[model samples]
Target chain A: MYLAQIHVTYKPSILDPQGVAIKDAMHRLDFDTVTDVTQGKYFEVTLSADSAADAEAEIEAICDRLLANPNMETYRYDVKELANQ
Target chain B: MYLAQIHVTYKPSILDPQGVAIKDAMHRLDFDTVTDVTQGKYFEVTLSADSAADAEAEIEAICDRLLANPNMETYRYDVKELANQ
Candidate 1:
């Protein structure tokens, strides 16, 4: 089995209202040093594949097709081998 | 300035409907090797601090107080020094 940890974020040119809201809140909380905030999605997935390359390809396809919206967001992921459990 | 990359995840005991939906989609797409999926949040923040330790503490506070729901999610972050951008 392999575990994939995915992180998805908005493209730099995109506007992120949620991130803005959080940044404002942080400022209100007196963490005024925070200049910018960009919020995104994270996913942890467990899967089995015949080879590491296959697992990575499957995950890349998954991210491109479902987990992220190509128009506004980009994603990256790390895959780790897991012991049978 | 320092960039903090935050990742928040639901505890193992928590339910993740979005993840389940994605997993189902993956299966429908014939990636049936996928066994489980857990969804969470990610954030990229830019801030300035006098020291790395201070920046980490500030981010930890932000996660605990605002970025993450203490009752449902746990968070971790990595801080990197920026090249002044």
Candidate 2:
């Protein structure tokens, strides 16, 4: 078994309203030190696989098909073996 | 400067459609070993801050305001010094 950590984020050129909102909130909260705020998603997946290579292929397919919005977002993943499971 | 790695994931009780869709895709791709696929998002931020404490507070504000869906998602972050920047 292995664990896959996936990340999905908006493309840099795209406007992130959520991030903008956060920045504005910070300004109001007296944290003037915050200049920019960008928001993204994170996932941890447990894969019941026999090998890392197989898990990688499966994870890539997952990203290409559903984990990311091809037009506005990009995805990446890291896979590590489960030491006890 | 420091780098903040943020992760956002759906609450376990909440249904994750994106994750389910990825699982189905994995099955179609002939990787029968993949039994479950949960999807999430990740972000790397470069913070121009004087210390890790300030960065932590800033990042927490980011999460409470925009990085997470308070009703359905959970968020976490790690901050590290940027050695070269």
Candidate 3:
């Protein structure tokens, strides 16, 4: 099987209130060295595909279609082969 | 400045409803090749630290204290130096 690690993040131009809140919380907690924070989604998908290329194609389609909003967010993924556990 | 990309994910034993929902949604959308999904948090932090080591230390502390639930989640991070843009 192939496992894909996907990261979907907001475009830099967008405003991220959750990130801002986290940054503020960090300041409140006394970690003022952190200047900014941008929050996003990370997904790990296990696919029943024969090859990494096949898994990549399926995952890219998924990301383009559902995992990320094309307008406000962008996504990237890495595919790795997994051995049965 | 240093930029830290942190990934916080649930332990393998934990249930991830969000991931399950996304998998179901993918099935509904006709992409059944995906067998399983796991979801987590991705954070891009811009820090005004003197060096990568310092940023890593601070981020590790932040992750331990506020960013993740130590009992339920495991976290990892990558730090990179960003050139002024």
lDDT of each: 0.92, 0.77, 0.93
Residues forming the 10-long window of minimal summed lDDT in candidate 1 chain B: B10-19
- Count backbone overlaps in model 3: 0
The order by descending DockQ is 1, 3, 2
Tens digits of per-residue lDDT for model 3, B1-85: 8999999999988888998999999999998888999999999998889888998999999999999998899999999999987
Model 3 lDDT tens row, A1-85: 8889999999988999999999999999999988989999999988888788888989999999999999999999999998887
Distance (Å) between predicted and true CA of B75, model 1?
Answer: 0.8
Q: Model 1: which residue pairs collide? A: none
Ranking by TM-score: 1, 3, 2
Better of 1 and 2 by lDDT: 1
Candidate 2 error regions (>4 Å) = B10-32, B39-47, B61-74, B82-85
Candidate with top TM-score is: 1
Q: Model 2: clashing residue pairs?
A: A41-B41, A41-B42, A42-B40, A42-B41, A43-B40
Docking level for model 1: high
lDDT of 2 by residue, A1-85 (tens): 8888888889999999987886676678676766566777766677777689988987887778766799999887899998884
Q: Give a tens-digit lDDT track for model 1, residues B1-85.
A: 9999998998778888888998999999888899999988889999999999999999999998898898888888999999974
Give lDDT tens digits, candidate 2, residues B16-78.
Answer: 899788677667766667667666666665667878998898888777876678999898789
**Reference contacts preserved by each model:** 0.93, 0.53, 0.96
TM-score, chain A, per candidate?
A: 0.95, 0.94, 0.94
